[model samples]
Target: MANVTKLRCNETVRIEQARIVALYAQLGQQAAERLMASAIEDLAMHMVAIDAAVQKNQLGAFDDAVTSLIPLARQVGMTKLEQVTRDLRDCMRAQDLVASRAVLARLMRIGDRSLSEVWDLEDMSI
Candidate 1:
């Protein structure tokens, strides 16, 4: 398997962290920030376990971690961030169906069209 680090990627993690920071700003300077700080403390506390699950290929455990982040993202009103987290969770839950079988059909159709165009070109000596 590819490195677990490739799963979230630095960009996604940065977006997640930025969403948390934006939530902090939206919640105000002191009191709400303190509350979110506490939550971050909790997430940090569990980080090792979450990372371990990801590294060990424990899909359920990894989903649990991604799931845990959603409420926190929602609390901050980071809807897109929340959606991305949910997508990751759903992919883990669905496994094989993550891409859905229909995409294969679509690609095949596209390939067939391209091949047909090639045949026509040959016939035209183009």
Candidate 2:
């Protein structure tokens, strides 16, 4: 989370490429890009909340930050970040491991939502 905040636009774009690779493995390149866009859109909603919290210097704003970031993380195959955010939230509430695991499981659900699967690894035998 802090790492994301530290990254510049170009760095973010590079990380974005990693996400593209993840989505492409399950769907195809085009579908993966589209999914990335959609995920970005979803994350934007939570970003709004995060921005608000950061402006106020309030630790309580972490909820909004996590909420905003997870959708984007899930979209980009960043299951770990999504899990960490979920873990923090659940622990903050009542220290529930089951809930955290469930949240992680939901992150994996993105693969199931893919429309198709294709790969351009055919002509690479050379």
Candidate 3:
């Protein structure tokens, strides 16, 4: 019998504080909060779409959902999430399923954490 160890991927995510601050300044706190909530909701939905698409081997759907996510992530300052999204997209472009799958899993982890942090920080200065 062999001992099996589980690995956890806790990727470091970078959020752009200045960017978020500017958003609050430009839109006013209420409007910015509304917008941020909407964007976060959309990002979560897209992650679900991407996961389902990947499971079904529907790359086109995955592309559509992921492409939409990059700008949304950038809008609210999820820079690391944006970069990981691109990395996964690049892997897909190269037609390397192995790497693409690996990156996809990483993307989901980063995306989940980034969204949560953003939502949690909505009430305070980041």
Top of the candidates by TM-score: 3
Count of clashing pairs, candidate 2: 1
List runs of model 1 lying over 4 Å from the truth: 1-29, 41-51, 96-126
lDDT of 3 by residue, 1-126 (tens): 999999978777768988889999999988998999999999999988987877677889989998999999999999998998899888877888888889889989999999888977886863
List of clashing residue pairs for candidate 1? none
TM-score of each: 0.44, 0.39, 0.92
Q: For model 3, what is the error of residue 52's alpha carbon versus the real structure, in angstroms, after optimal superposition?
A: 1.4
Q: Tell me model 3's lDDT, rounded to 2 decimals.
A: 0.87
Q: Identify the superior model by TM-score, candidate 1 or candidate 2.
A: 1
lDDT tens string, model 2, 1-126? 355456322111113345556567779867766665676556545545544543444447756677668776666655644554566466545645566445434433322222111122212221
Q: After superposition, how far is residue 76 of candidate 2 from its true place, in Å?
A: 1.5
Candidate 1, residue 6: Cα displacement in angstroms equals 15
Better of 2 and 3 by TM-score: 3
Please provide the root mean square deviation of candidate 2 (C-alpha atoms, Å).
11.7
**Model 3 poorest ten-residue lDDT run:** 117-126
Q: Candidate 3: which stretches are off by over 4 Å? A: none
